[model samples]
Target: MSARLPENPAPLTQALDACRHRDPEGFHRLRQAVAPAMLATALHFVQDVRQSEDVVHDTLLLAWLNAGRFAADDLPPGSWLFTILGSRLHSQLEALAGRPPSAPRAVPTGLQGQALWTLAHGLEPRPPSASLGDRLTESLLARLAAPQLPRTPTGELVHPPLYDARLRRKMLTSRLAYQAKEGFKRRLGRPLEEWAFRRWLAQRSVGQWLEAQGLPRRSVEAALGDRLDLEVNPGRLVRCMSYPDAFPDRTERRKASNLFLWSGDWDLPHHSLADSSRTRFIQDLWTHRLEPSRSETFRRLEQQREQGRPLRSHHKGMLLDSRERILEYLRLYLLYMENMACFGFDKHEGKDRLGVTIDRHGRIIKTNKGLHRLAMAQVLGLSEITVRVRSVHRQWWQRHAGDAKGRDALERVAQALPECVPA
Candidate 1:
């Protein structure tokens, strides 16, 4: 028997009818309504958020394009949608299993029964064979290189990179004391819509913003191309190529990025090898105490607490987020003995370095974890920090067309794409 939908199917039915009538607005509305649930389902099976997004994106597009073929006798609307999602899911699984060995895979491999973190150097670009052309990136870089580029945060062109040499020469001849300052309005602490709006106005470029504030200029394109000769010295701060959606406040994002402090204000050691050995016993406890192995560990622990017996300190709270869950099986760097942290590709909608969809005008998406640590590294002027990067593309509705009400929602979801795309 076909599984029934949890709610009334009228909304989906209406969206389908609208799509049959060739209404773009209707199709978009439908996508917004169902994409999240569909994506959640996809994630359960695929385990990779990016792959799951692909399945949802392809499924929605296919469903929209072919909705006209459905007849009165067709299966329930929910079942039909599931059928498409399932077909896409199958294809994704097959693609993973049959993938060529030469191709880079982010599969978490077990090492000595522990999950090992994958290390990705920033300067390495994807091989040409796997290239997805990105014209949006080209456009953004060209804009940044323009002679009229903004030098100050408030759009003041006091001393641009092009004129830095001139300023240096003048300083030698005369006393030149110039303080570049921009009373940047704090855009954070506002509502989500307002935060996203100002971010949109900022063009979502953390690197450019850093340059405007007189920091060292780093070409985003160069970093993405892996052409920059950046030395990987521990604790060095690298400018961000992607804006983080995890943080919606522009002021907060800017503070986090400029200071390289994405994680938190605390100076706790994170995901380092020095602490890995100490945590090994804890790791073993977690591993062997898997639901089956320590089937009654939680129960016994609770009972001991009830009896007034002290529980082991290892009895930490439950883990959360996609990164933490994946770390249970794969050996990766854990943040503060809880979260898994790595430098995956910038999966932010406008910030994806891969440029799978070319419409994003080259904006930096936000980072999920380690924002504070990254910002702090930059603030401390370190030479290098190793980051593991995963390539990412925008999710579905990449090419939506509509008024502000419709398009803004699409873009907002796009920014939140990283939350759904775990590496």
Candidate 2:
């Protein structure tokens, strides 16, 4: 395949032109436009991290100086850049390797931008991969999982007004309808939706409804089309959300939970939601300073168990509610304290990993998704833990990778993954 990706980036000539005249923003734009592709080609072709980086840096530095002589139409800037890059590579080992890597002196943030590109410049989706669950389980068994993806914080993330009458009203209506449908489906024993609608009203919606009668709603769709993103976190990711968001009661509930995805503006003061009893109690129990029996979550489960309530709900089905799955949970908490914590976070990506959502700026927000392990991480102070990026805001995809196509988007995500996690 050619060094350039099949598609050309937005005109690099203009940005280069701006550079010729010494314009700062133009320089930034030009680098953003071509740096990833240039670096990808160089790195993949050379298979040397240090050498590839130097080649890209030297090529860009040379390009900056020759911005005036550069013209766009004669040859794509990507092609020209790669040409220079290849030339640079010939000398990198002998001439450039020992020389200090070229530091971007134009802007202080130059280093930051390069760091982001290195992190986001990923090959997450070339050879097609297994589900996030499978990969995580494999890693866990091998005992080689360390996950931390540090998120780039937006200007200021402020929570929007929590009470919106119209939205809440609509949400209420949707919930009521869902419960009614579920009630009917449960009563009918879910023979693919139900026959009442089919016989009485043979519509497409009814037919579709019939197809989805008893199964729990589909929850795992990070949508690499059919593939899931690799759980590569080079930075620390504090588990973001709670159980309710992680395990919504209804399908609509999950969709409506998009409230956190909204831009609350970085300037406004943001306060994390008060830690739920689940988080607080677990931290308390983690110390063994307090008896696990004193935990309200544990006590509630004990009482519920005595009353014949299931200790772990949904014992054998999709989207199990283990809302009451507390007894064994206590034992597992001890396992970690006693140095037997083998099940790294990713192993639970199928359900309980710290689930989070990214906003337009790729800021991971708490959605109450994975509290149990999140609490453990807090107590353990583990530097790295795998996360289930359950969903990303539409704007996040658009902003990170325009067009947001599957391959590009996932790569962009992988590139960004390093920034979100700790080094």
What candidate 2 gets wrong by more than 4 Å, as runs, is 1-252, 256-274, 289-291, 294-329, 336-353, 403-410, 421-423
Off by over 4 Å in 1: 1-6, 99-423
- Best model number under TM-score: 2
All candidates: TM-score: 0.24, 0.35
lDDT of 1: 0.36
lDDT of 2 by residue, 79-122 (tens): 55555454444334323333322211111232223332343245
**1-423 in candidate 1: lDDT tens per residue?**
112223666777777878777666656666656565565566666677655665565566556655775453666565566555654554355446643211122223321001110111111212211111122122223323543532332223321212333233443223222222211222322233244434433546453343233221122222223421122332322223333433457876565433211333212222332233223333333333213124243344445545665232111212212222223322211111111111122222111222211113222222334453333233223344433222222222233312322225334533443323111
Q: C-alpha displacement of 352 in model 2, angstroms?
A: 4.4
